[model samples]
Target: MLQDHGFDVQMVGSRKAGLMHHEGWPGLRIDEIDKKARFSTPRLLPNVFTINAGSNDCLQSFKLDEAGVRLGNMLEYLWTASPDSTILLSTLIVSADKKTDLNVMRVNDQIRALAKQKAKDHKKLVFVDMNCEAGPDVRCLVDGVHPNDDGYEKMAKLWVNGMLEALRKGFLK
Candidate 1:
C-alpha cells in the first residue's frame, strides 16, 4: 500500500513475503514479542515499525491486566535501542466471541491510553484503531479466530492510513 502511494519501501525482519521482510510470527502475544525481539544494534532497527500485538494475550488470557505495561516495556526497549524510529501501534481486530471481545476491548482501552500518554510525551508512536477502522466481520473469521481475506484488506488500508498519519504529523524523522 505504501509503495502504491509512491514511497520507497523495504521491509526488514525474519518473515518474508513476495518482497517484504517482517518480524511478525503467527500466534505470538505481546510479551512473547518483547521476549523474542532481536534487534541487538541500532543498525538493525528500521525507521518504521507496525505492531498489531496483544490479541493472543487476550485470547489466551495471559496477564490480562498487564497487557498495557508489557506493550509499554516493549516500546521502551525499542526506543532505547533505536531512538530514531516511528512505531505504529494498532488495536486488535474485532473478534468473533463476546467473551474474547470483552478482553479485546479491555486491552484496546489500555492501548489507547498508552498511546495518548506517549503522544503527550512526544514519543514516536502512532496509535491506529484497527478495531473500528478495519471492520473485520465475525462472519469473515476463519477457524473461529483469524479474519478472512477481505478483512485483511480492510486492515491493510488502515495500516496505510496510520503510516500516513505519522507522516502527516511529522513523526517520522
Candidate 2:
C-alpha cells in the first residue's frame, strides 16, 4: 500500500518465502529474523516496526504477566536496537469468549501502558491501539481464536491507517 502511494517499502518477515520471491515482488524483503530474536544486537531496523504477535503467546497457557514481561523485553530490545525507529505495538486479538477476551484485554492494557511510558522517554516511540481501531466486533476468529478473512482485513486496515497516521504525525518520516 505504501508502495502504491509512492513510498519505498521493504517487507522483512520472520521466515523466508523461498521460491515465492522468484515471482518478482520487488518490495518484499524476506529475512530470517524471529520475533523472539529482536533482542539481539546489530538488529536490522525498519523505519516503522509493526508487531502483530501475542495471540499465539496467549494461547499457550502461559501466565499473562509472563507474557507481558516477554513482550516488554522484546519492545525494549527493538527500542534499543533502533532508537530512531517508530514502534507501533499492536494489541492481541482474541476470540469473543468472555474469559479469553478479558485476558486479551488485560495484556493489551499492559502493552498500551508500556508504550505510553516508552513514548514519554523517547519521542520516536508511539503506540497504535489496534484493539480499539479494529473494534471489539472485528477481532474475532471463527473458533474465537484465529482471525478469518474479515478479521484479517480489519487488522490490515487498522495497521495501514496507523502507519499513515504515524507518518503524518511525524513519528516516521
The lDDT for every candidate, in the order shown, is 0.84, 0.61
lDDT of 2 at 111: 77
| lDDT by residue for model 2 (38-144), tens | 43334445556776556654554457766656676766676677777776677767656777777778778877877777767765655666676454363357667
> Which residue runs does candidate 2 get wrong by more than 4 Å?
17-35, 39-43, 136-140
In model 2, state the lDDT of residue 151. 78
Alpha carbon deviation, residue 92, candidate 1 (Å): 0.5
Note each model's CA RMSD in angstroms.
1.6, 5.9
For model 1 the local lDDT of residue 31 reads 76
Q: Taking the tens digit of each residue's C-alpha lDDT, what string does model 1 give over 1-173?
A: 88897668878876677786778878889877886674432556788888889999988988889999999989988888778889999988877788888899999999999999999999999998888835676766785579888888888888899889998999875
Name the best candidate (by TM-score): 1
